[model samples]
Target: MSEIDRNQGLARQIAKNIQDSIMQGRLSAAQRLPSEVELAERFSVSQPTVREAMKILAAKKLIQSKRGPKGGVFVSPPSLDIAAQTLHETTNWLVSLGAVGLADIVGARRSLGRLSIAAACEHAEREDHKRIEAALLELDHTEISDEDFCRLEVEFHQAVAAACPNSLLRLVMVMVNEALIPAANMISFPFRQRDKVVAMQRQVFSAILVRDAAEAISAFDTLIDYQSGIYDIALEQRTLGSRLR
Candidate 1:
């Protein structure tokens, strides 16, 4: 093998070793890693190889680098945004490949939405309420475009998800919302439909504000049912257009 190939292999091995250490809790979050020269000495490799390995770990978000004194490579802390983004990307890929369908997405959303409502009702604080209220206020503006309305809809759901105490559940809710919101925007919303959507949002918010789990769940179901109906219509139209073609 060429010298370059050998260096690449060594770098991958070094990166794997560090990843294993991080995953197995041998290295804790924010723990600084050895300098390039130190790691090169320990791994019996050149400094360039160790630097390449560090780059790999950085791309995986397993480690971070700093510039100044007191600055070096450190294990990255766990991040909900990163986890949710990964999940969203994977879910979108599945939908594109026809491995997951609109029905499946809707079903998952319905199930998760109920759970979020229950948790939010129990654990929502003043800040969470304020976020939901802010989204609702923007949504109530009748002059807003459908694009703005859809964006606020996402903000509103995310605010509710933020109110949930379980980090894992919140992460999953973020993934589901990210996948569903774009699909939801494909259906054109007439003025009447937009008003209905806003009314349902109000119902859900009111129930949440009062910490009423049952009412919130009911309101959520109504909202999901309305959305599902519109999605079904959009799918049918698309299918029919293809048939005509």
Candidate 2:
């Protein structure tokens, strides 16, 4: 019989070792973990101890279990909640540095985009492809002044980021897209300019539909470049107004 100190909340050491293995990619997403009997032997603990350790990992939302002939513990990829929390943490880190402006956020987003685009190209799913189409159709009919359009823009990007193979990278992409939607609407632009903004979204979505990752990424960059240009214009206006004052 295997020895185990059951009074303890499982073996913290055993749990940590398993957790570390997952984090270090010693185990990969969807990879099967050993059976309780196997794990008990490997960790030198009782089957109950291995069970406890698996529970700890499950509570973190890091691994999921299935049953049957094919049943076993498998690595859980990041869920939206996990992905979003990771992003929010990064955003908070930047905020700690000082007052981060729209331009600063945009720059960080562009740098992050390179990673997101690459991952999306590698892992986009069928439903994600549908998400792009749905977002675009909504935008196509949305009133120019509709806040719903802005919401769709954010939704579209979130879907795009989620398509990425790396859930962690999608997290920052979510934050950046969230950052952009509000800024995009804040400035008053000519009707033509607004149309251009809508057109660009369509362009990027189309690129994604075509499975052209390079074009999709470039389209996003062009959208940001335009936003940067507009932000600079807004700054110039503020400067002029201050001079008059």
Candidate 3:
């Protein structure tokens, strides 16, 4: 039993080492790793232990394995899309597990929105403004459905966040925006409500265009506060209905 535990520990360690190599660019994406026998020899572990380590790495999307005459494990490339998706899923899990509440999500969205706006004031370029303007224009269309408006609203926020120079900050905004989807889907905006939201979005965008970070932040807060109030009311009604039943 002790020997088995030691072997398991070794496999985990090996996985970490390999993970580090891939992350640090020592192992390039699509580059094949050594065979299991070679890895075992190099690590001074049994072949089964090396295989176990490979399995661990494979599960993390750090590597992929193939079986045949010309197949071996290769480094999996890093992807912002995948990372954003993982963050979205993890956030949902936290909410489901009661580790995070709706209030926490709102708070995070506001804070991150402020930070991104500040960064954007410093870093936004002509192209970024164009992208944001296009998204903003979509909100003004009168014939669009409530669902389409909601989706475009998300896209508009994403365009604003993308103006920030920091990739990590942009990624965080992506996660926050995606996390709001499940709740956003629950509340359909009436025509008046949609118009109000579009007005707020225009204020935020105009502030951003002028590089007024403070105004942009203020407008964003207003938008978030309004949306939060609506969501809170929906949540309360949901809870009340559930209890009555």
Top lDDT: which candidate number? 1
Error of 1 at 15 (Å): 1.3
Instruction: Arrange candidates by TM-score, descending.
Output: 1, 3, 2
Ranking by lDDT: 1, 3, 2
Clashes per model (N, Cα, C within 3 A) = 0, 0, 0
Q: What C-alpha RMSD separates each model from the true structure?
A: 2.2, 8.0, 4.1
Model 3: residue 118 alpha-carbon error in angstroms: 1.9
Quickly count the clashes in candidate 2: 0
TM-score per prediction, in order, is 0.90, 0.58, 0.77
Q: lDDT tens string, model 1, 1-245?
A: 99999999999999999999999999999999999999999999999999999999998889998889899999999999988887888877887778877788789989999999899999999999999999899998889987888888889999999999899999999988887676556553532387788899889989998999999999999988888888888777878989999
Candidate 3: segments with Cα more than 4 A from true spot: 1-17, 20-31, 40-55, 64-72, 142-147, 181-192
Clashing pairs in 2: none
Q: Which predicted model would earn the best TM-score? A: 1
Off by over 4 Å in 1: 187-192
**Considering only N, C-alpha and C atoms within 3 Å, which residue pairs clash in candidate 3?**
none
Choose 1 or 2, whichever is better by TM-score. 1
